[model samples]
Target: MTPKVSIIVPCFNHAKYLNECVESVRNQSYTNWECIIVDDGSTDDTEAVSRTLESDRIRYIHQENRGLSGARNTGIKNASGEYILPLDADDTLNPLALEKMIAVLDQDPDTLIVFSDTVTFGHTSKKSNLQEKFTLKELLLGNKLYCTSLFPKKYFDEGIVYDEKLRHGFEDWEFWIQLISTHRKQPITKIDYPVFNYRSHPETSMIKEITGNTDKKEFIYHAVYEKHKALFHEFFPSYISLLNRKTFYEKKLESIYSSKPYRIYNFLINLFR
Candidate 1:
C-alpha cells in the first residue's frame, strides 16, 4: 500500500487564496492524503472558508497569532501520516507532486526528504532551483530549499522543528539545517519537474522584511551560525570571506545607483521606454 501523505497548510490573513491552495491538494493524483489547515489567528474569513472546505479528509485548527513557525509546528504536531508536506497558504503544489515525491521516498530507504524546483507565478514567471541535495556548506551560505516539500513526520517526533524565535523569516533555513545535520550522509533528492507554484504577491511583508531589515537579517545569520557553529566551524574562514565580498559588491552597487551619471542614464532609458 502507498504511504499516506498529510499536507499541512498554514493560513494567516489569506482567506482569499485558501480555495486555490486546497484545490491543489484535492487535485493530487495520489489520493491517500489529508490536509490540515491551521488558521494562525487570521482576522479574515479564514474560519468561514475553512468550514466550507472541511471534511473527513480535511481538518481545521485555529491558534493564536504565533507567526509562521508556530503555525507550521501546530499543524505538524496534529498530522496523522507517514509523510509530511508543508504547503504555505498562498503557494500550491503540482498535481503530480505527491505521487512523484512519494515514489522517491519509498524506493530509497536512505532518502527521508524530497523537494523539487520552484515555478514562480502571479507577478513573474520563473523557474528556481530549490537545490537537488542537502549540503551543510550550501545551506549555510543560503537557503535554496523552499518551505513546501515532502518530509517525514518522524523528525518532529524526534524533536526537530522550526524555531519560533526567528519569527520574521528564514525560519525554514534554520529548520532545514537542523533536519539535515542530523542525517548528513542521506542526501536530499529532487525529482526533475514536479514543481510547486510559488505565488509572488506584488507587495508582501516578507519581501519588505528581507529587503529593509538589516538588523533582523544579521540576527538570523548570526543565530544560525551560533546554533550550528560546530557544523560550520571547518568552513568559517571561507564563509567570512564570501560575506565580506558580498558586502563590498553591495556597497559598490549602491555607489553606482547614487552617481549622477547612472541616475541620468536610468532616467533617460525609462523616459524612452
Candidate 2:
C-alpha cells in the first residue's frame, strides 16, 4: 500500500466555504489520503457541514477556540498519515496536487518538505509571492514556503510542531524556520507546477496585520528571533547590518514624507485624482 497522506483543514467560521474545501481533497487524483477538519469553536454551521462530509476516510473533530495554530495542532495530533499537508478552509488544491507531491515524497527521503507554486484566484488574481528556492539566510529573512507545503510526520515526532503562541500571525513562517533549523541536513524542494489554489478575498491575509501594525510586527519578529537565537547568532553581524539598513531607509522615507515638496506633490496627486 502507498503511504497515506493526511490533509488537515482548520476551519473557523468558514462554514460557507467548507463544502467546496472538502471536495477539493476528495477530488485529489491521489487516493490514499484522509481529510481531517478541525472546528475551532465556530458558532456558524461548521459542525452541520462537516458532519455531512464525514466518513471512514474523512474525519471531523471539534475544539474550543484555540486560534489557527491551536486548531492545526489539534488536527495534526489526530492525523494518521505518514505525511501531513495543511489546507485552509477558504483555499483549495489543484486536481494533481497530491499525485505530484506524493511522488516526490516517495522518491526523496532527504527532501523533508515539498511545496509547489501557487495559483491565486477569486476576487483578484496575482503571481505567487514565493520563489522556487531559498537558502537558510533567505528563509530566515522572509517566508519562502506556505502553510500548505507537504512535510513528513517525522519533523513533528522530533518535537517540532506549530508554535501556538504565534496567534498574532506569521506562524507558518516561524514554523518553517524552526523545522529547517532542526533538520538542517534535509532540504525543502519545490515543484514547478502551480497546484495550490489560493483565494484572494476581502478577509485578505492575516499576515497583512504585521505590515500595518508595527507593534504586532515587532512582537512576532522578536518572538521568532528569540526562539531561534542560535541561527541568528551564527549570522549576527550580517543580520544586524540588514536591520540597520532597513532602519536607515525607513527614516529616510519618513523625512521625505515630511518635506514640503513631498507634501505639495501628494496634494497635487490627490487633487488630480
Candidate 3:
C-alpha cells in the first residue's frame, strides 16, 4: 500500500550523519511513512549506510551533485505519497512529527502546508524558540518557517519546484513567495510544538554573499531592504501605508543596532560565523 507521507532527505557528503537521520525516520511513531533518501552524488559511504536499512518502506535514489534545491525538486518529482516532507540529512525529526502533522492536515483539508516548531541546536546550546505562523510578506522578508518542515504533495503537482539557479541560499523562501504570489491565499498552518531538531556544527558556514563580512552585510542589508520595500508597495499599493512600512524598517534597523548593544554585537559576530 502507498504510504500516507513521503519523507524526502537529500544528502551530499553527509555520510557521517546519514545513518542517524535515516534511523530517526524509520523509528517514527507514525507507521505510514516511506523514507526517500536521495544521495546527491556523495563522495562518502552514504550508499553503504543506507544499505544498512532493513525496512522495505525506505527507498534510496542516487543522483549527481545538484545542490539542495535541485535535490529536493527531484524528490518531489518522484514522490508517491499524498503528503510530502523534506528533511535535511543533518537533522532529525521527533518520532511524533509525522503523526501530529498528518492529524492536523486531516482535520483541515484546506491546509496546503503544515509545519511544526523546531529546536535549533548548536554543538553546545540550543538557539531561539520556534516562531508561529508567518504571512507571505513575513516569509519573503525573513525566513522563519524553515524549509525542511512538511509540505503537501499536491503543491508539487502544480509544477511548483525549487529554483535550481539559487545554489547558495534563500531558494525555499523564494518558492514560498512564488506560491503566495500565484495562489493569493495558500494555507500554511503552523503548530507550536517542536517536531524537528536542526543540527549546527561548530564549522557550519553559509555561502550567502553577505554572511561573512561587514561590508557584505551592509550590502545585503540594503539589497534586502530595497527588495522588501518594493514588495511592501506591491502588497499595499497605497502610498501612505507603503511609506510607513518603509520608514518602520529603517527606524527599526537604527534602533536595533544603536539602542540594542547585544543585538549589534550578535550581528557583527554573525558576520564572521
lDDT (CA) for every model shown?
Answer: 0.86, 0.87, 0.75
Summarize candidate 3's per-residue lDDT along 147-232 as a digit string, tens digits.
Answer: 86677778678877787866656667666666655666657777766777888777755633445554554443344445446665
lDDT of 2 by residue, 104-162 (tens): 97788778899977888888887685677678878888788889999988778778889
How many collisions per candidate? 0, 0, 0
Candidate 1 residues 67-181, lDDT tens each?
9999999998998888889999889889989989888888995786788888989977888865565567777788868888788889888999989988868999898889988
The model with the greater lDDT, 1 or 2, is: 2
Ranked by TM-score, the better of candidates 1 and 3 is 1
Best by lDDT: 2
Pairs with backbone N, CA or C atoms under 3 Å apart (clashes), candidate 2: none
**Candidate 2 stretches greater than 4 Å from native:** 1-3, 238-241, 251-273
